[model samples]
Target: MSLKPSSRDWQRAIADARQGLSAWHVWNLLAMTDIRQRYKRSRVGPFWITLSMAAFVGGIGLVYSTLFKQDIRTYLPYLAVNYVVWTLIQGIIMDATGVFSSSGVYLRQEAMPKTLFAMRLIMRNLIMFAHNIIIIPLVFLLFGVWPDWEMLLAIPGMIMLLVAAYPVVMLIGMISTRFRDTPVIIQNVLQIAFFLTPIMWKVDQLGAAAPFVVGLNPFAIFLRIVAEPMNGRAPSLWTWGVAILVIVLLYAITGPLFARLRARIVYWL
Candidate 1:
């Protein structure tokens, strides 16, 4: 009758999350199984992810370097960090919209914590990200790139990424499971976002429009937090401020919405 999340509902949501997190072995198994099934019978298993990313970086780095008239050494590493970070971001979100519905059979059969599926999704993408990141060290070696102390900041940046993933995946998974078409719409928007984000181009190239673009685009903001540190530059303080703000806002919004809908979600699927 009422749409508000009652105190009991909020407690249940929190408990579900706490329990889901504590059950790491279950989610890890599910995540690893996903990777194995996806690459089954392949010669190198998930290394295919690394090889494909390497090809894209090499091919695009060469072509875009000439197009932008930038030096290959500089451009290639730049592209590698940005593209790899972007892949992790894009991959989680792309799969998140379908996470719950895809696992409907499991959810429908028994009592399962919804947050576990969210964790499973994050873990799966992280594995692919690990594979994809193999190219980074190789790129650094090939391009003679040296690490800077600033690169250490990427550790916190990565932690922030994982922290942000749980809520975002849970929120999107809930909504898309309720409304199937939401996934299609999100898929198209992500395609546009890929270009709007400065993955292949330096933000400086935007000149007068750079500030507005970065300020408004959360993708660019989060991307900078991780990629800039890896690229040997510390992100500006404002970027960190914005990223923390986005994480706060995401939890703020999803916490209540998830509490309200957590019970209803199974029916929707």
Candidate 2:
């Protein structure tokens, strides 16, 4: 057996991605079913996710505003957007760790494209994201943040995020399958990152070192690309450059790794 992925493997992987994209009806049905199962018999159902986010944003935003001595008006909205985007990012990575492992029954039984699971994960989080994001407009309305055309810029940033998410989840999920400990390590790292990134705290508070901090954090980079636009500030050219470059590099890595591992992933389960 050869260790290297050949041209055929690359082609097959591309075909898998295409099939996954085309299997929209299947994955959307699967994703919605997962959501239904999770919230089964609940009164508010998925609105619990929205309410939970509202609680965190309201509670933490108020306290952190006092702690940081920032104005409540600006701070709350900032926190709302950052936390919402972060939740989507966080959810995707955490779910990715088990995207395949948890779907062992489905994968083992059907001749399904593995990318379909990845799509299902993305769809699931996006649905949750929709539920959570209503807090942003509510916070904005209370804080007097009227939306303008600039907010439309965030649409592209969101597009970039979705673009980055597929490879991010696929790569992480593959690695997590090979090494079971990856999920725990990732959880710890995300906790550390929550503190390290400028979610609750503004980056400018770091004084002269803010650039260096955000520059090094991929999370911060993606966060700024989306959250900044939503906050009515365009992300700097540096951020756009870094974000695009990160996607390019991420795809370059995920493509080959996934091609090699796609077939073996089911076996790992």
lDDT of each: 0.93, 0.92
Write down the lDDT that model 2 would get: 0.92
RMSD to the true structure for each prediction, in A, is: 0.9, 1.1
Tell me the TM-score of each prediction against the true structure: 0.98, 0.97
Tell me the tens digit of each residue's lDDT in model 1 across 16-50.
99999999999999999999999899899999878
Tens digit of per-residue lDDT, candidate 2, span 142-198? 999998777888999999999999999999999999899999999999999888888
Worst 10 residues of 2 by lDDT: 1-10
Candidate 1 achieves a global lDDT of: 0.93
Q: What is the lDDT of residue 96 in candidate 1?
A: 95
* Decoy 2 TM-score against native: 0.97
Candidate 1 residue spans exceeding 4 A from truth? none
Give me the displacement of residue 102 in model 2, in angstroms.
1.1
